[model samples]
Every structure is written in C-alpha cells, then in structure tokens.
Target: MTIDDHKSHLITLGKFLKQFQTSNSVMNSDIPGNNKFFEEMNQKIDSAIHHNGWFTRENIIFALQQWSEALTPRNLKLWLGEYDLSESGDKTVGIVMAGNIPLVGFHDFLSVLVSGHKVLVKLSTNDRQLLPVIASYLMHLDSRYENRIRFTDNRMKDFDAVIATGSNNTARYFEYYFKDKPSIIRKNRNSVAIITGNETKEELEKLSEDIFRYYGLGCRNVSKLYVPENYDFDSFFKAMYKWNPIINQDKYANNYDYNKAVYLMSEFKLLDNGFLMLKEDESFGSPIATLFYEKYQDEKELKDRLKENEEKIQCIVKKESNTNEVTFGQTQKPQLWDYADNIDTIDFLSKL
Candidate 1:
C-alpha cells in the first residue's frame, strides 16, 4: 500500500482509540466500525486488568488517551514528513514486545508498518489481551492490514530484522541470537529528575505524575531524583501527597509495606511519608514504592557525570530544556518524533 493509505488507516485507528480515553467508554458513532468493535474493545480493557494486576483501568485509559491525542493527522504528517518512505522496502520485521505497561511495544509495531514492512509480533504474555484487539480494529479499517500484522505465540522465524525490548539479562540473549541480523536490542533504562530546590509547588505536583503514573513501571517513569545538598523535602513531600491514594491499590500497597519492612529491619535510613519512601542511592533504577535520590553539590559536575552515564539513562527531566531533557510531567507524554534511547526507529526502518 501507499504511504497515504497507511496514514489514513492509522488516523482512523486513532479516532477509535478516542472512545476509550476515559474509563467510561462513550460511543462515538462518527467513528467507523463502532457498532462491531467498540463494545468488544471495552470488554478487552477489563480483561487486561483481570489478567494483569498492574493494569488498572485508570492507567489503561490514560495510555489510550495519550495515543488518541498523538495519532492525529497533523502529528502523523509532521512525524513522517522528514522521511522518504517511497523507497521503503518490504521486509518481515520481528518484534519482541515488553509488557511492563499497556501497549509498551506499540511504537515499534507502528514504525515497522508505517515504514513499509510486514511485522511479526511476539506479544508479552502479560500484555497479550490488548494489542490483538487493536490489530483487529485496524484490519476492520482495511483488509490489507491483515496481511501486514501477525502475532505469534510460538517461536519467531522468517524475519529479516528484529526490535526487542527487555531487561539487561534478556538483552544479552537477544544480542547473541540476533547477531547476524539487523536489530535494535533495548536494555533496562530509567529516567531521573533534577530538583534544583527552585521548583514551584505546581511544578512539583506535575512531577508527581512522572513518578506515580502506571505505578512507575514504565521506563519513562522517574525512578530517581537529583537534588541539591541539604535539600529540604518539605515542599516536595507536600506536593507528592496528591497521589496518596495510589497506596490504596492492593498491589502498590503490598509493595510499599514489604519494601518498608525490609528497609526498617535492615536499619537503612529512609525518608517516608506514609505511602512512598526515599533513600539516598547512587543507582538509577529504584524499586517500586521507593524513589532513590542523590545530593548534588555542583551542577556542572553532575551534568558531566550524567552525560558520562548516558547509556543507563532514558530521560533527564529538568525545569529547563537542553537538547534531550524533557520538561517535568512530559516524560511519559513523548511526541511521535521523540524516539527511545535517541535512536531513530523510522530511520532504522527506512534503510532496511
């Protein structure tokens, strides 16, 4: 199919996604195939929550809402405008999806298809319920999509290249197995925020979304913080209180209680405000219900250190934007062009 044909189908998919932007799935008769697909999509949302404890209705809807907002005609045009897709080749690209959050592997799926390639998907068992229904929606949009998308439960084969996302351990296996093929093997990466102690309470409150959304499971979540030495957390703690209800969720509460007990028994120093705990740590990845922080004495030295360790970091959130730094609250709300790991997915696909 032509590039315009692909864009037309995607824009329709985006409109279908708009109906589920909230937990209350309102029917939009203007969207095509709503009579057949809308109710089924709503049922699958609940099924996703049933299958995965972390897939709460609120977070699932939030993710859908973000995608609905992103898949506009303007966004599609702007993102694809830079590329020359007319020369794009048709290859079967194998995708190994990660299930940390709902639809986490979708961008790779979209990239392969939009850039004129067939996709062979291996869905993460935790997230198997959602994307198939989405693929069904696209197939409804156009029968041609049926030939473009394939989901496999068994071993993957007959693909010229691959894009895989996993933990550091699985990354090693992917690197070794896909050695001879063209690939993008992603490893564990975490985001961090820089608190200069000058942030407004409003800004910090927005920052809380970056910390607690999807219970901080996604790579875009800010798992660590860098604050000035002797930084008073009184305001920060007060701002975070908005999400106190997050602890009421059984899974999150269990993690909070268990992590707290371990810290107390080990006699490790911690900062607690009922729901979340903060500890001074040098690492980037922090466990759920806990946010690791380090005191920075010099901005220049810390920036240099962060630049030195760019591979381990996914995003650097700050009050000011410089190069790749995302503003507070926008980490999870990446635009179409904001590629993961600064690696251009479309550029990778165009030449394949």
Candidate 2:
C-alpha cells in the first residue's frame, strides 16, 4: 500500500466510524441483547474494584473518543507514513488485550491495522464487545480489513511480532514467553499532577473528574498531587464536594467502602475530611479514595520533582502559570500526535 492508499483507507474507516456512531441500528443492535456485555463489563469492574476499588464510564468514553480522534487521516499519516505502504513482509502480530479498563488495547489494534499487517487479537473478557463492534463497523466500510483481522481465544503462536499489556508482574511472564519474538511489553503506569496555589475552585472541581473518572483505574488518571503546604484544604475540599454525586452510584460506593475499609484496617494515615483521602507520598500511583499530595515550598522545587518523576508520570494538569484558566479534563483528551511513551508506532510497525 502506498501513502495514498493508507490515507484513503483511514478516511474510509473514519467515515464509516462516524456513520456507525449515528446509526441507531448498528449501535443498538451490534451488542448482544441479553445484557451479556453489561454483565461481563460489570464483572470486570468488580474485579478492578476488588484490586483497585474504582471504575467509571466517563473514562471509557474519554478513551474511545481520544482513539477515534487520533485515527484521522492526517494524524494517522503522521504516525504511520505520509503515503507509503511498503510492506514489512508477512508479519503476524499477536496482541494480548488488557481488561483493566474498557477498550484499553484499541491503540494497539489501530497500530496493527494501520501497519497493514495480520492482527491476531486475544480479547480480554472485559472488552469483548467494543472491539468486535468496532471491527464490525470497519468491515462494513472495507471487507479487506475483515480479512486482515482475527479474534482468537487460543494461545498465540507462529507470530512474527507481539504486543502485550499487563500488570508489572504479568509483564515478566510476557517477556519470558515472547522473548524470542519482537514485542512491545507494556506494564502498569499512572498519571499525576502539580497543583499550584494559583488554581481556582472550578479547576479543583474539574480535577476531581480526572481522579474519580474510571474510578482512577486508568493509567492516565491522576493518582498523585503536588501542592504547597500553605494551600488551604478548605477551598480544595469545597471544590471536590460538588462531585459527591459520584459516591452515590452503587458501583462507586461499593469500591469506596471496600478500599476505605482496607485503608483503615491497614492503618494508613489518611488526610480525611469525611469524603476523600489525601496522603503525602513520593509515588505517582495511589489507591482509590486515596490521593497522594506532596508539599512544595516553591515553583522550582515543584518543577524539579516533576522532572525527576517525568518517566513515571503520563500527564500534568495545571492552571496556566500567568493565566487564571484551568486545564483539568484536557489531560485525558490526547491528540493523534501524542504517541504513547513518545514512540513512533508507525515506525515500529514498518520495521516488523
């Protein structure tokens, strides 16, 4: 495929997706009617709660939109190639999807598809519906894509390259099993923030969405905070209080109780003011109902700490230094150019 071919294919896929998005029949009927998808998703959310204790539909929607936006022809060309479909040979790529969050592995799926390689995907039970639905739409646009893609339940073998996502512990297992092949093994990661005193109440409230959305289960969710010690907790809590409706949800409440009890039983020192927990920490990731906030005396110290922790952090949402405007929810809205780990996925695929 040439660069033109790639662009044409992407434009077609994009248009197809947009059509599917508006088509009531496809959107409403593609998913199983027996509540199977919901049941499976609920079960996955339950497991995530048991392990991490938070989940939200907001994160899932945010992730899907980010992916769709990034799939535009212009953006896809930048990551893939300007107009070259020079084959990297007959590459069979095995992708192991992660069920930690909904559609967590779509990026990997897009990478494989855009590369024009055969993709054998092992669907996570948590995300069974989304990928198939997406593939159905893609196939509707171009049957060629249907032939290139395959979903499997069997152990992957005879693949030229592999991409797997899992916890830090499971990553070791993936490395051992797929060591002989070229692979990208993704481990667990989380985002954090540096909250200067200059932020407004509205900003803090919006920040609450980032923390609570997806129950703080996503790698992009802000799990830690950096604030000045003199920063008043009164205003911060007031801003966060607006999101109290989050706890009223049955699933969120279940996770809240489970994690809250665990924290109490473990005797973790919590900065509790009735609803949320704030703790001081050096790590970027924190448990749900628990947020880590470190005190910094000056901007230089805060910048230094951010730089020191740059590799571990995914994003930082803060107010524009000179301006009073808040940039809170923007962290989750990644552009097409925002390649994961700053690695050019198209370049990686072209070589495979």
Candidate 3:
C-alpha cells in the first residue's frame, strides 16, 4: 500500500479507539465491525488488569484516550511532515516495550510503521494484552498491516534495528545485546516539578494529576519537587487531597503503608497526607506513594542543577517557567511531538 493509504488506515484506527473510551460509548457514524471490535478490546482491558496489578481501569482509559487524541490525520501528518516516505521499503525494527505505564512504548511502534518499516514487538509481560488487540484492529482496517506487524514473547531475532526500555540494570543488557545493531536503549528516568510559592490552588490541583495519574508508574509522573528554601507545603497538600481515593486501591495502600513505615523506622522526616508522602531527598527515582523534594536557593541554581542532571530527567515542569519547561500538570498529556528522552524516533527510523 502507498504511504497515504497507510496513514489513512492509522487514522481510522484512531477513530476506532475514540469509540471505546469510558465516557464516550457511541459508535462512529460509519465503521464496519464496530461491535465485535469494541467487545474484544473491552475483554483485553479486563485481561490486562488481571495480568498486571498496576493496569487499573482508570489508567488504561487515560492511555487509550490519549492515543485516540494523537491518531488524528493532522497530528500524524504534522509529526511526520519533515520526513520523506518516498522510498517505502521493508526493514524490521524490533521493540522491547516497557510495562511501567500503559502503552508506554507505542510511540516507538508508531514510529517504525510510519517510517515504512516492519515492527517486531516483544511485549512486556506486564503489558501483554493491549497492543496485540490494537494490532489486530490495525490489520482489520487494512490487510497490509498484517505483514507489517509481529509480536513474540520468545527471544527476538531477524530485526535490523532495535528500541528497548527498562530499568537501569536491564538497560545495560540491552545496550550490550543490541550493540551490533542501530538501536535506542532507554534507561530509568523520572520527571520533576518546580514550585515557586506563587502557584495558585488550581495549578497545584492540576499538578496533582501529574503526580498521581497512572499511580506514579510513568516516568513522566512528577516523582520529585524543586522548591525554594522554607517552602511551605500546606497549600500543595490541600491540592493533592482530591486524589485520596487512590490510596483506597489495595496495591497503592500497601506501598504507602510500607514506604511510610520504612521512612519512620529510619527516622526520616516526612510530610504525609494519609495518601501520599513527601521527603527531602536528592534522588529522582522516588518510591511509589512518595515524592522526593529538594530545596533550591533560587531559580537560576535549580536550572543549573537540572541541566547537570538532564540525562536523568524525562521532563521538567513549572508554571510559566520557561520555553522548555512543561506547564504545571501537563507532564502526562504529551503531544505526538513530545519525543521521549528528547530522542526523535521518526528521525532515527527514517535515517535507517
């Protein structure tokens, strides 16, 4: 199929996804096989939750909705506008996906296909359900996708290039394993938010979304805070109160209880709101149910430190902070152009 046809098929697939989100149940105006597709995807959602404790319904829905928004023709074209797809040829790009958050590796998968390359996806055991069903949907939209996508649980082989994401330990293995191939091996990274006492309650409330969404499983979630010395957290805690229901989940509750106990036993000072805890820490990889924070002497000093640790950060958030800094609470709602690790997957795939 031609590149435009390929793009149209994905756009249809996106429209199909929009039909299945929680709040919107209505079928699109004209889509064949909608009933069966919706039913099957719903079943996959249930299976995914049963397979992984962290795949809660809310998190899955948020992920699906974001992809639906991203799959529009405008977004797909805008994201790929700079690249030339004139020489469409088949090359297999192997992807080792991460299960940290739902569909976290989809951008890489999309990059491979839109660049006119075949994809061999090795799904994370923790995320075994969602992508295959989506792949089935894509193939149903157009038979060409059937030849374009493949998934395997066994060791991956016969791929020209690779993209893998995992913790720092697994990252070393990936770097060594794919050393002979053109590859992108990602390491653990966490996001942080900078607070200046000037933030309004509304902005803090939005920031709570960045912290609690996906239950802090995503790298984009704000696991650390950079605040001025003597920063008062009273207002921030009040804003975070709305997410108290998150603690009601058994897994989250257990983490909160366990982490809180560890901190107390170690005599570490903490700020707790019964659901989430904040501690003064120099690290970015905060424990689930906890947020680490550090005092910054001033904005300039914080920016300097952030620059020094740029590789460890996925995104930095601040309220009208600067051109590069994300607005408060927008960390998770990334656009198609917001490449992970500041790496352009399309450019990587295109040049291959």
Candidate 4:
C-alpha cells in the first residue's frame, strides 16, 4: 500500500475512535463498521480502570479526543507535509513503549506506520489494553496493516531500527543494546512552570490541570514551579482548589499522606490546602498530590539555570516568561507535531 493508503486507514480508525468519545464523539453514520468496534471499545474503557487505576474514564476519553482531533485529513497532511514519504521505503521499526499514560506511545507507533515502515511494538504492561484494539480496527479498515503491525511481549528481534522510552537506567540499557542500529532512546524528564506573579485565576486554574491531569504521571505535567521571590501563593493555592476532588483517589491520597508525613517528620516547612501540598524544594520530579516550588531571583538567572538543566525538563510552561514557553494549561494537550524531548519521531522513522 501507498502512504495515502496508510493515512486512510488511520483516518478511519480516528473516526471509529470518535464514536465512543464523550466530548469529541459525533454521530457519524459514515464511519464503517463502527457499531461493533464502538461497543467493544466502550467495554474496554469501562474495564480499563480495573486493569490500570490511572486509566480513568475521563483521562482515557481525553486521550481519544486528542487523537480524534489530530488524525483529521487536513491535520495529517499538515504534519506530514514537511517530509517526503514517497521515497521513505518500508523498513521494520521496533518500538519499546512507555505505559506512564494511556496511549503514551501511540505517536511513535503512528509515526512508524504512517511513514511507511512496519512496526514491531512491545506494549507497556500498564498500557496493554487500548492500542491493540485500535490496531485491530486499523487492520479491519484495511487488511494490509495486518502484515505491517505486530506486538510482542517476549524479547524483540528482526527490526532495522528502534525507539524506546523508559527510565534513565532503561535508557542506558537501550543505548547499549541498540548501539548497532539507529535509535531514539528516551529517558526520565519532568515539566515545570514559571510564575511571574501576574497570572490570572483563569491561567492558574488551567495550570492546575497541568498539575493534576493523569495524577501528574505524564512527563508533560507540571511537577515544579518557578515563582518570583516573596511571591504570595494565596491565589495559586486558591486556583488549585478545583483539583481538590483528586484527593479522593486512593492512590493519590496515600502518596499525599506519606509525603506530608515525611515533610512533617523532617520538620520541612510546607503550605497545605487539604488536598494538595506546596513545598519549597528544588527538585523537578515532585510527588503526586504535591507540587515543588522554588523562588527565582529574576528572569535572566532563572532562565540561565533552566537552560543549564534543559535535559531534565520536558516542557517549560509560562504565560510570557520566555519565547519557547508553552502556554499555560497546554502541557498535556500537545499537538501531533509536538515531538517529545523535541526529538522528531517522524524524521527518525523517515531516515530508517
């Protein structure tokens, strides 16, 4: 099949995804064989929470809605326009996916297939349920994908190149294992936000989403904060009130209790809001239900420090702090082109 053929299959899968969605889903009669697929997906979604507590209904739907909005004909064309896929002949691309968030590795999977390469994927045990169903729907859309898509729980072999995402230790293993081939090895990274003390309740409220979304498990979630020295956190804590409901999640509340106990026992100062804790710390990887904050002397010095530690960060979120700042509240809503770690997956696949 040609590149357009591959795209057409994904477009159909996106349409099928829309039928089960709550927000972006529509009653499109044109999406073929969606009745069975839609009902089946609904069952899987209902059971997803049992499989992985992090796969909440709302978060799963959010992931589906993002994909549905992204896989449109126009969006796909715009994303793929920069590359010459016609000359990008087929190769076998092995992918080791991360299960931090639902469909976390779908982009790499999509990139490999859309760029005319066969994909051999090892699904994260935490994310084992969803992608395979979507892959099956794609194969149903066109049987050609059956030849191109494969999944393995065992050791992987017989692939030209590899793309793996994991912790820093696993990343080192990937580097050594795939040293003989072209590869993209991803490591642990966290996101941070810079507050200028001028943000509106609306912006801070949205920033809360960046913090609470997916229980702050995603690399894009804002795990740290940079605030001007002597900045009052009254408004910041007030805006975060919306996510107070997250404290009801058992896993999150346990972490909150444990982290708060650790802080109290150690005599570390903290500002608590019943649900979330704001602790003055220098680390980027904050615990769930807690956000680490540090005071910045000025923009220049803070940006310099951030620049010096760019490798540890995934995205910088702010209202107007820097040129590359991702607008507040958009950390988890990255577009199709927002490459992880700014490494171009499509470009990597195209080269393979």
Q: lDDT (CA) for every model shown? A: 0.93, 0.67, 0.89, 0.88
Q: Give the TM-scores of the predictions, in the order they appear.
A: 0.99, 0.80, 0.97, 0.96
What ranking of all candidate models by lDDT puts the best one first? 1, 3, 4, 2
Point to the candidate with the largest TM-score: 1
- lDDT of the structure predicted as candidate 3: 0.89
lDDT for each residue of candidate 3 in 140-183, tens digit (9 for 90 to 100): 88888899999998999999999999999999999999999999
Q: How far off is residue 310 in model 3, in Å?
A: 0.5
Weakest lDDT window of 10 consecutive positions for candidate 4? 19-28
Model 2: residues >4 Å from true position, as ranges? Answer: 1-63, 77-89, 265-267, 273-275, 321-327
Which scores higher on lDDT, 2 or 3? 3
Evaluated with lDDT, which candidate comes out highest? 1
- Mind giving the per-residue lDDT tens digits that candidate 1 earns over 308-339? 99999999999886989999999889998999
How many clashes in candidate 4? 0
Query: Which candidate do you rate higher for lDDT, 3 or 4?
Result: 3
Write one digit per residue (lDDT tens) for candidate 4, span 1-352.
8878877877887777766665444556778877657767877787776899878889999888788878889888888888987767579999999998989999999999888889999999898888888888888888888999999999899999999999999999999999998999999999999999999999999899899989999999999999998999999999999888898889889999999999999999999999888899988999888889999888888989999999999999998545556988888888888899889998888777
Error of 2 at 112 (Å): 1.2
Please report, as a residue range, the 10-residue window in candidate 1 with the lowest summed lDDT: 17-26
- Cα lDDT, model 2, residue 134: 63
